[model samples]
Structure formats: structure tokens, C-alpha cells
Target: MNHALKERIIAQSKQLGIDKIGFTDASSFEHLKDSLEEQKAAGHTTGFEHPVIEERLYPEKIFDQPQSIISIALAYPTKIKEKPDIVRGERRGSFARASWGVDYHNVLRDRMNKLMAFIKEIAEDEAALTFKPMVDTGELIDVAVAQRAGLGFIGKNGLLITEEFGSYVYLGEIITNIPFEPDTPIENQCGTCTKCIDACPTGALLGDGRMNAQLCLSYQTQTRGMMPEAFRPKIRTVIYGCDICQQVCPFNKGKDAHFHAEMEPDPEVVTPLLKPLLTISNKEFKHKFGYLAGSWRGKKPIQRNAIIALGNARQKSALPDLLKVIEEDPRPDIRATAVWSVGEIVGSKGNPELEAFFNTLLTTTEAPEIIDEINKVIKKLH
Candidate 1:
């Protein structure tokens, strides 16, 4: 009788603009627990994930008498509609597809709320029932639940790949006391393909879905501190997040779903001019980018990455802006990055005016960090 409720949910989810939905028994994730432990021991977690191992593996800890978990996947767009040109002298940085749309957290939560309300309405006359909905930031391992529910298989690149939607989906789930028939786990589809692994600039993707989060460019981009020296060039033009692995995935090929209007990208915000980000006020930054998922770490990381991107571009046109940031930016890290960009843009330049200014700051700067950064860039310039 409770199994019939699953049919109603499928209908409700479709009505709510949810791309895909599946159900799994609310049992402990035994296999995932072991893998998570291994990841923790090896320091592979991205720190953005839930820190508690037990809570992440056990559904019962979240909801009393939990009997089922409903895993939902919402497909997002891959290709932009009428993307703006990124011409020379006006180079812009890229935000990963995941950050292109309005924050998926809100979109997924709204859909989950509607589904929860519908479930409550239908189960009102039955035994006491409860549910807990969780998105990307939630404690439960979303991909594991989705895989168990047969929504998709976990690919080597550490993303869930559904047959219909490929790997371009935002996942969320509702753990409930109401029992639902469990779905079969999807068969592993990645056969002898190493594109995502070979294509990863940092080699973050270990074989068979394991990953080293510390070396991941996507993970590094969200960090506020200066990026690792070796990875700066690898960071390329991504100011916020990276999509290299996903871009190379075969399953993600020809998979662009414009399912919801809310998921559409404002190309201007997603691919903003790198130089402008160096000076955007906090209020303006929030107003322009706060709606996107990439802005969660605030402007520091974005600004830092923008500096790295400018260096990678080696844009002589950006040299003035980079020098201005080095001279005036309050953040030491930002200024340090600007120093790096300046060196990349104009190596060993004989420009008299800039040379005089550089020598003046090197002799006059009080902060040791800034002085050291200026000297390091000076070495690179020579």
C-alpha cells in the first residue's frame, strides 16, 4: 500500500520541475562509510562537505524511524544561450556551469518543500510520518543515495551520471519515515574511459570515483588564501569554479538541459571582466554575484582567482589595473597576486616610470608579507 505513494511522488516531482526522482531504503550506507573513512584518513574531503562521518553515513540519525530516502536530480544547462565574446583587451573569467544559474540550493529547496507538503497531505491519515530535506550542503551523502535509488551511477570524475541527463544534475534528497519501495542501483556505465582523469589539470580525480580534494582546482578556487604556486597556471581563466573534468566527460557530451528558467545564466555575471573584479566593492559584488553559488565564499577568493587569471592571460592591457591593485588594494593576498600579475604581464620591462614606482615601494613598504611578495615578483621580472 505504501509503495503506491511512490507513484504519486513521481507525478508530483514532475509537476514541480524536478528532472528526475528515485527512492531507496533508509539503511546505513555501509560501503560509503568505509570509503568516507578512507577519504578522511587520506585527507580527501573538500571541507565544504559535512564533517561528521557518522551523520553522513547514517540516515536514521537525521529522522526518527527513517524508512526511505527520496533522491532528486535537477539537470542544469551546459551551453549558454548567446554567450558574450571574450575578445582581447577585454578578457573575462569563467564560472563553472554549476555556478551559472541562480543558486541551486534555493531552486532545489523550493522543489523539495513542495514535495514535502504534498507527501504530508497524502499521508495525513496514516501513521506518524516525518521527513528531512537536504541539498548539497546537507549531512547525508547525496550521490550515494541517488546511486542506490538508481537515478545514476557515480562516475570516475566524482559526479553522478544519469542516463537521460548525463552528469549535469544538481542532487537533493528527502529522508522520510514513510516506507517506499527501493529502486535498483544503476549499472556502472563508464567503460575503459579515462577522459575526465586524463583531462584533469591537477590530476585530482583518482581512478574509480576517488579524488584528492586538496589538489582539485574547483576546491582551490573557493579558498581565500593564495593558491598553491604549482596550480596557479593550471587555474587558467576560471575565477570561481572549474569544469575541466566535467567538460571532458563523455556522458556530459551533447547534454544541455534548460529545464528551468531560474537555472539560466546571465552571461555578464558568469563571465565578468577579470580586471573589474579586482576593484568591485563588497556591496556591488554581492548585488551582482550573490545570487550565484560561486559567491558563497565572498569576494576574497574570487578576487584572488581573478588576479591569477590575469597573470595567466599575461594581458599587457591589464598591467595598469594590476599595478593599481598592487599599490592600493587593502588585502595583502590580493596585492600579492597583483604583483604576480604585473610580473607576468611585463617581464623585465625597461619602462622608467613603473620601474621607479616599484623600487620606491620595495624600499618603503612596511609589511614583511607585501615586501616579500614584491621582491618575489621582481625576481620573476628579471
Candidate 2:
């Protein structure tokens, strides 16, 4: 491919909502297959088979006769005001800022498709060179490719960080048969900065860039099924994703760090009052949060998160909602969370209603797991 055409593609990518774009020779990622195997051994990459990812690691699989990989970074604005008090209980609902707007995966997919169309138009005469665009969906290790393509360096938080946008950008890539000149990779800038590691409530980030996914709060909250007992209190108020490490990064300092247009939380769900969130009907949950990223886990996890948040907040006002979920929720895990939240709410106050609920649970001849939890809570209360 001509250098001029490559430059034009980069410029067009910026116009298509990508903040940064860089190209790399398709052959540069030869070592990715080995690295992925190492990650698998370390338990960093789960639910992904090596063979599937190996195919994508070799760029030819994405684009036969491929010569270049165009990596693009879309900066998710992080311009919200800090409400430390809200972390305590002064706020209503809470969600990570990145998830406040429309689903980023969807946003990036739409833009990538447009860029591919432009590429096809410009390269129509070149034996119809093929192209494949991918967001976070593919088997590709997007951050590693972006780093090799010189978009940004990986920070201590295990996030790709750009000097201008800190680590608030999402990455996507397009592999094409058209070869383009590659850019030099940027230097690692995280010197002596331990903020992300220090701020992690669950110690997910070790000194090395490697992260323990099992201990990660973000992964914990989004995961379906039962959460481990030890990490429950550490979850804080997060319903979807965790941003404690990002929030404390020195690179993200100052009011200017906030991206005004995209950082603000949705008013309906922003710092949602825990009392109301626990009682949200399934219909209301779908209508309010369906478009947001957090809704992917469905009403159960969010509801379970709400209960946990209420427990952490010690909000007595959330008792009724907790009671309702405890009695009526179809999911056993959700009922279990409600039981825990009610216990927290009634913590020395010991509401008669809650005591009565526990009494009824004790009489029940079914769901031994729930009965055991109820008994545990009652024991704790006494």
C-alpha cells in the first residue's frame, strides 16, 4: 500500500471517532501464540481455547496475504465529578463511568464497520483486498496489538494508557491485505507508580502487569452464579464494573481529566438510591438499564449487587425492598443476597419483621442452602 494512502486511512479513522490509530506489519505478532499459552497457564485468559486464538494470532487467518494490522483506540470520556461521600451512602445508585453511556462494544462496532466500508471503497481496484474489523469480541489480544502498533503503553492497572486520555480508551483493530508502514512502539511510562495496585481492594493487580482475574472486583461483579463469601464486602457499591484503581491513577488527575460529554452518569441509574434499586421490577430494570453495559448480566446480578451495596451502606430504608426480594425472587442466589442485606440492615436494630422472616425460613422444609444461610444470619444477629 502507498504511504499516502496509509496516512489517509489513519486520518479517516480519527474522523470515524477513533482518537488514535497506528499500523503494524502483520508478521510482528509471531510471538503472540506463545504469550497466550503463557497467559493460559497463568489463568489470565479463561474460557478461551488456545487453538481458536492461535488462528487469529497469525494475521493471515484474518486476512489472507495480510501485510498490516491497523489498530485504533476510542477514548471513553471520564469527566465526572468526584463524590467520595457517595461511596459511603450519600448517593443512590453507582456504576463505573465507562458503562454510563451506550454500550462501548456496540459504539465501536458501528464505527469500525464504517471505517471498513471506507477502506473497501478506496481499495476497490487493488484485487479487492479483504479486511476484517474486530472490537473486543474477537480472539485477538487487542491491547497487546495496540501496544505493538504504537497506540499507547500498558499501565500498572493493566489498561492501555495514552498520554492524552490516560487509560480511558477502548481498542479495536482491522487486519487487511494492504501493507502499511508500521510505527515504533511507545515506552512504558509507569515508573514507580503503585496507585492502581495499592488502590485495588482485592489486590487483583500484583507488582507485575499480570492481574489475578479471580480476585478482580470488576470480574467478580459481572460474573454470574454464586460469588465467594470472602469478597462480598469488598465489592462495595459496584453493580457492573469496578473503577477504584482507575479512579486513583495519577495520570487521571485533575478536573480536566473528566470527559464532560461522555463521563456523566445516567440520572435515572446514576448513584441509584439503593432502596429503589433493590425493589426495581424486572420490567423497570430492562427499561432503565437495557441499553447500558451492566444490563448484560441481567436483573439478578444487579439486584444481588444492590443488596450487597445496601448491606455495605447499612441503609435501613432498604429493608422493605430486601424483604420483598428475599420472599419473592425466583433466583436462590438473589434471595441469599437479600437475606444478607436484611441482616446488615437490621444489624443491632434487629427489626421484628426480619426476625419473623427468619422464623418462617426456619420452618421451611426445602432449599437447605437458603435455610443454612438464614440460620447463619440469625446466629450472627444473636
Encode model 2's per-residue lDDT on 132-215: one tens digit a residue. Answer: 788666756688778889988888777887777777877898888787888898877889989899989988886666677778
Cα lDDT of all candidates, in order?
0.87, 0.74
lDDT of 1 by residue, 1-382 (tens): 4767789889888999999999999999977878888988999887888888899888877778899999999999998897787666788999999998899999999999999988888875645777899997998888888999999999998889999889899999999888888999997789999999999998899988989999999899998777777889898889877888888888888999998999999988898988889899999999999999999999999999998898898888888788888888877777877877777777776556666677798886776667776777666555
* Separate clash counts for every candidate: 0, 10
In model 2, residue pairs whose N, Cα or C atoms come closer than 3 Å (at least 3 residues apart or on different chains), thus clashing, are 78-258, 78-259, 79-258, 79-259, 92-271, 92-272, 92-273, 93-271, 93-272, 93-273
Worst 10 residues of 1 by lDDT: 347-356
**Among all candidates shown, the one with the greatest TM-score:** 1
User: What is the alpha-carbon lDDT of model 2 when measured against the actual structure?
Assistant: 0.74
TM-scores for every candidate against the unseen true structure: 0.96, 0.89
